[model samples]
Target: MNYFQIWGIGFILTLSLSLSAQQVPDTGYVAHWNHPPYAMGEGPVVGVDGAHNNFHKLNAGFRAFGNVAEAGGFRVVSVDESFTEESLSDLDILVIANPLHASNLGNWQLPCPSAFTAFEIKAVDRWVKNGGRLILIADHMPFGGAAYDLGMNFGIEWENGFASIESGGFGDLFTDHFAPFTNADSINSIRTFTGSAMSSNRADVYPIIILSEGTLNLPTIAWNFDSLNTAKPLAGYYQGCWTRAEKGIVVCLGEAAGLTSQLVGPEEYPVGISTPRVGGNLGFIQDMLISLAPENDDFMEALGWLRYREKTTKVGDIPFRFQVIDWQRQPDGHIMLSGEIIGSAVSFEENEEDYFVVEVGPMESDDPNYDDRFSRWRQVSEFTFSREPIVYPD
Candidate 1:
């Protein structure tokens, strides 16, 4: 699909500090998916943090983030309360984007305190250790400083500064940097606006977006680069990384705009995923979310019920059964449900929503006229099974 057709063709070559203030969510932007992993509202629940004075919320800056997750078949909802055991109990994944301390609200400078309290940090740490995934994003100086404590608890050392390449404040991150996560053949590049950099000494932590030769300028005030600022080379730092936290996982991004689709300035110039340069960002987001989501056991349980029915039922006084001998996932993210009934094999591609019969013949035979032979069983049945008992119609 052509992203330009949806995002339009107004790209901003450079994003200045002045233009950053004018940025807003692109309300028209919609995340398109060729194959959603689950049925609508059937996937894992994702909570977008709205408390702690976050700069990105569901109805505002991170609107595109929620849309992307929803398009990928996850249920997205806003989290309006602080981090706690009870508050995070129901969430499969927690996304905290550019959260800020109340003291730093509208005033980005030195003395940027932690957005999360000691109790909140401990709660989050325990929650992740108990199997709650987290996506922590902090951008630039103040944001990095704000999320420092929460990030540090997970082994990430946030540099509270602006990361800039030789080109400018924004640059394209290539596939080489996404090692152990994605490959060059899968994705070409991802564009990121001016953001911060981070590092982790933990061996378990895998680098996602590593910075090339660049400078990290630590200014006392946000975006105020002067001689007074302490500048350091950002050669080995990371813009994004991920690691496992006991039973759960943590994905830390030093930048926020890369996950967002927003318009900048009066001209409405595109930035982040909306820009033409970052066409692969949507795919990246989908892959990341799939990794964060728990295994799809609901589909497997539903299939188990069918297997049980096959083993117990009979047709016309003759023992009738269809057993799923083998199954595998296709390249398009659909499952190939392969089964045998009365020594004849049938195979079909299925998503969580429904099953589609594609072929039917002998186990190792290839028949061109198989479609004609199994015309009546083109579709097996829609899987409406849940934890409750199945009721049959008389």
Candidate 2:
């Protein structure tokens, strides 16, 4: 097998804001559990399956991310069954770690195997299309191979091999492995320890973590790191990409240890996201999660609160019902609402209005009740008001 490249540069986000100390609520809605054959363990592992046998929370597994998500007001729960509409409906995010459905040979394998069924893949795809978020973490050869099929549904293509750089020197085991995030200062470096690469040409996709130009995705006919004879390096493939679905979001990363915290063997060499010397992997992942779904807290707060349409609503006298999509309190003590407008096709003239004006139409549905209630849902970006909404905490 020969390696290939993913061309083009991505539009990197240049802005960096001070991280907010504002706390979000733990909604107990995160489904971190995996339906086995996948690499995600329920609790902990104590044995090896091929090259990955360790089961401790601090190893290459996703336990560290689970812990972080838990601390950041998310309820991390393990999943063991196949993904379905009803099963995934209530969750905010579903994480699929490196899964290996077949036996893991300790030797370097060229192509890993699939852990997910066809039905499961379709279910996940539909779930994301219907307002569900998915986070996929696939590692080196075998892990990449296992996830290849599932990722294809989202317009992602995995290289199904090991990706590294010539600068790292192919001889060293751990010391020579590292990957860097492009145009991001907060989470600048990745301590890559044998991971794969991925790319997407879909219009809905955007690169988040990009390997540098010199990065190479080397084909592995077998897990033969000792022999580089058949290896052909492909340059500049995307290591991570985020896609915006019809109503949901999908985050895919080529490497796993970038967001992991683990000790390697008895010597206890740190080689994960939690390593003190590691770059912005931890912070970068946290920021990505926050950016993806910060509205969970707002949704929870507004669950039962009701405000009069007159007092709580209207963008320039359009009389639209308020639906909070994004509510954030900036570090400067300013609270902002970038949400949706319901029940109206509203627009505003710039000269006469004090705030930015945007045109949005009504929602469409066959049900009279639903159509009347939510049919006119249009986005309202950066819409600020003098009075606070009912859901705002004092």
Question: Cα RMSD (Å) per model?
Answer: 14.4, 13.3
Runs in model 1 deviating more than 4 A are 1-20, 166-175, 182-185, 296-394
lDDT of 2: 0.49
Query: What tens-digit string does per-residue lDDT give for candidate 1 at 242-352?
Result: 887767778898777778888888998877788876656777787677656767322232343344455465644556444343344444444444444442232223212
Estimate, for each residue in 261-363, the C-alpha lDDT of model 2 and write its tens digit: 5545455544455445555555555555554452432221121121222235666667654444334454533334433344455644432222222222233
Candidate number achieving the greatest TM-score relative to the actual structure: 1
TM-score of 1: 0.70
Scanning candidate 1 in windows of ten residues, the lowest lDDT window is: 1-10
Q: Score every model by TM-score.
A: 0.70, 0.57
- Look at candidate 1 and give me any clashing residue pairs: none
Error of 1 at 279 (Å): 2.5
**Least accurate stretch of 10 residues (summed lDDT) in model 2?**
10-19
